[model samples]
Target: MSEYSQNLRASYEAVWGTYQQFTERNEALLRDILVEGEDYYAIEARTKDLDSFEAKVDLPEKEQKYKDIAEVTDLSGLRIICYLDEDATRVCEQLGELYDIDQEHSVNKNEQLDPDQFGYRSRHFVVAFPADRAALKENARFVGLRAEIQVRTILQHAWAAIDWKLRYKNSAEVPQHLRRRVFRVSALLELADDEFSSLSVSVAHLRDEYERKVDAGDLSIAIDRESIDIFIEKDVDLEALVALAEDIGYSIAPNHPNARDPYGGVISTASLAGMSTIDEVRTKIAEVVAKKEPRLRQVFEAWREPDRPPRLVVSKAGLARLAIVLSVEVPQAVALVEKLPFGPKLQSALLDVLRNG
Candidate 1:
C-alpha cells in the first residue's frame, strides 16, 4: 500500500493476461513432463493476484524493495504438490531439462533449513521455456515470460495451506508462546512425509521383486490382488482370451480387474472346478471361455428371444465362475435361478444371462 508500490499497480495489471497465458502454458508443459513417468498428488497454476504481489513489493525492506513491479518473480505461479518430498526434487530436475532455470531467483527451501529444523520445504524455481519448447504450437506465444514453480510434499502443502488460511503475514505474527508448538507440529508433519516416501519406495521394491518371481514362473507366491496384476501383466496368454471373447460376440476389456487378478478372483472361482495351481486355473479358464458357443446352445435351446440379445458379456470374474458352472453341471446353474442362493437380484440376473444361451 506504499505510494511507491501504488504507482506500480497499473504496470503489473498491464501484462496480466500475458502472464496468465504463460502460467497456463507452463502448467501444460509441466504436465507433459510428468506424464513421461512421474506422477504427483496435484499440479496447478495461478496468476499471483494484484493484492498479494502488491504486498510483496511494498512489505520488503526499503533496501530490498523492487524498483519495478515486474522485478517480482512470482507474478505467475505454478505448484506441483507431490506424494513424496523426493518427487519434488525429481520434478525440479526434469523441469531444468525443459526450461532455462533462473538460478539466482530460485531457492531450494529444503536445503536452506538448519540441521535440526523442520519447516516449509518447498522448491521454488524461476524459469522460461527454452527456444525449442517455445516453438511448440501451444507454447509459441508468451515464450519469453518467466513463472515461479513451487514443488512441495503433500504434508508440506498441508502446513502451507493452514498457515496461509490463518492470515499470519510472517513468523513474527505468531505468538512467541505458540511458536514452539507450531514448530513441533511441523516436525511431526516432516516425520510423516518422510515415512510416506519410504513406504512408497519399499512397496515399489517389493513389487519389482515379486514381478521377477512371476517372470521366472514362480507360483509359490500366494495368489492375491497385487500378485495377480503382475501375473496378468507378464505371464498370462492374453491373446487366447481375447480371441475366445471375440468369437462369442463378447468384448473383453483387457485391463479389467478380473483379467488382471487371474491369480485372485479367477483362481478362486476355478478352485470350485478343482483348479489350484496357476497353470491349472489358466488352462480351465481358457477351456471354459472356449466352450461358450456350445454352452449357449444348451442353455438357450428352450427359450427363444432374438430381439432381446442375452448379455453374455460378463466381467472376467463372472466369466470364470460361469465357465466352472457350465463345465460342471448345467442343471445346477438352472437350479440356482429358482433357489436364488447368491441373492434374488444377482441370481435372477444370472438366470437372465444363462437363459439367453
Candidate 2:
C-alpha cells in the first residue's frame, strides 16, 4: 500500500471507532423510549475507503486543493432501522437532540421523484460530533468529520438491501430497458409501503372499536382470543361480564385483590343482565352493594381485620351462564365483563349479561 493509503486507512479506522462510540451512546438512550412490546434493532457501523486521497498526487490541481486533507471516510456508514414509521421519526428526533446534524433529508416513496435518478429512498442526515462532546475526546482530528446516518422503516430497508445487492453485482451499469424495469420495481415497493400503512391504521381502528364496545356492556361481543384463553385458565370467565358492561358504556374498574381471590370471584349476573340504561346499571350496582354490606358485616364479625375485602363471589355455573348470554346477545360483551370490579361492577355486569342473553 502507498504511504497515503496507509494514512487514509488509519484515519478511517479512527473515524469509524468514533462513529461506533457515538452510536453506542445514543442507542442506550433510545432503549429507554422503546415501547414494552415492540421490537427494535440496531446495525453495526460499516466503513469503506473513499480512495479520494490517491488523486491528490496524480492530479496537480487536485493535489493543491487536497494537500491538507487528512482523511475521507471509507464507506463508514451506519443505518438505524425501526419497525414503525413513528419509531423512525422518534429515533431521528432523538438523534437530532443528541448529535449535531448538518443536512437532513427525507424522501417519502408516496411523493414524486425524478425517474432518471437512482431512487433507493430513505431519510439521510449528515451528522457531526457535538462541540460539547468534542471536549470529551482529546484528539481534535475527528472533530470536523461527518458521518451519514440513514433512517428507514423495515420495508424501506428490505428494498434498499435488494437494490444494493443488484448494484454491487452489476457495477451499477444498467441497460436502458433494465433501468425502466427498476423504476417499475421501485413504484411497486412504494405501493407496498402505502398498503402496509393503511393496514396498520385499520387494525388500530378495530382495536379501538373493540375497547369501546366492551366498555358499553355489549355482552354479545366476542372477547379477544388471548384474553379469553387467559380468563378461562384462571377460571375468571365471569370477567366477560365486564365486557358486556363496557359495550353499554359502563366503566368497570378491576379490583386487583379480588381478581386473585377464589371466594371473592362472585360476579353479579343480575345487575349486568338488568341494566338497560346507565341509570339502571348504577341502581342495579347499588343493590349489589346493599347485599354485600350484610355479607361483609358477617364476614368481619367472623374474622376481624381480614387482609382483603370479601369478594362477592359467584359460582362457576353462573360464570358459564354469563358467558353464554354475552356471547349470544352481544358478541363484544365478554371484553367489557373482563374489566369489571369483583363486587358492584361484577354484579352489574352479570345482570347486563343475563338481560342481553
Query: Against the hidden reference, what TM-scores do the models get?
Result: 0.74, 0.50
Q: Model 1, 1-357: lDDT tens per residue?
A: 777777666688887878888888778777876952255778988998778767766775743467776577788899998878788778878888988999999998888976444466798999888888788887776666788999888898988887677654345667888877877787799899889889988878878888888778775665555555565556454445545655655544444433433334455554444555555545555666565446533433223346644534444444444445555555655653344233344455456666665
Which 10-residue window in model 2 sums to the lowest lDDT?
295-304
Highest-TM-score candidate: 1
Residue-level lDDT for 129 in candidate 1? 80
What would you estimate as the lDDT of candidate 1?
0.67
Global Cα RMSD, each model = 5.3, 11.6
Model 2, TM vs. native: 0.50
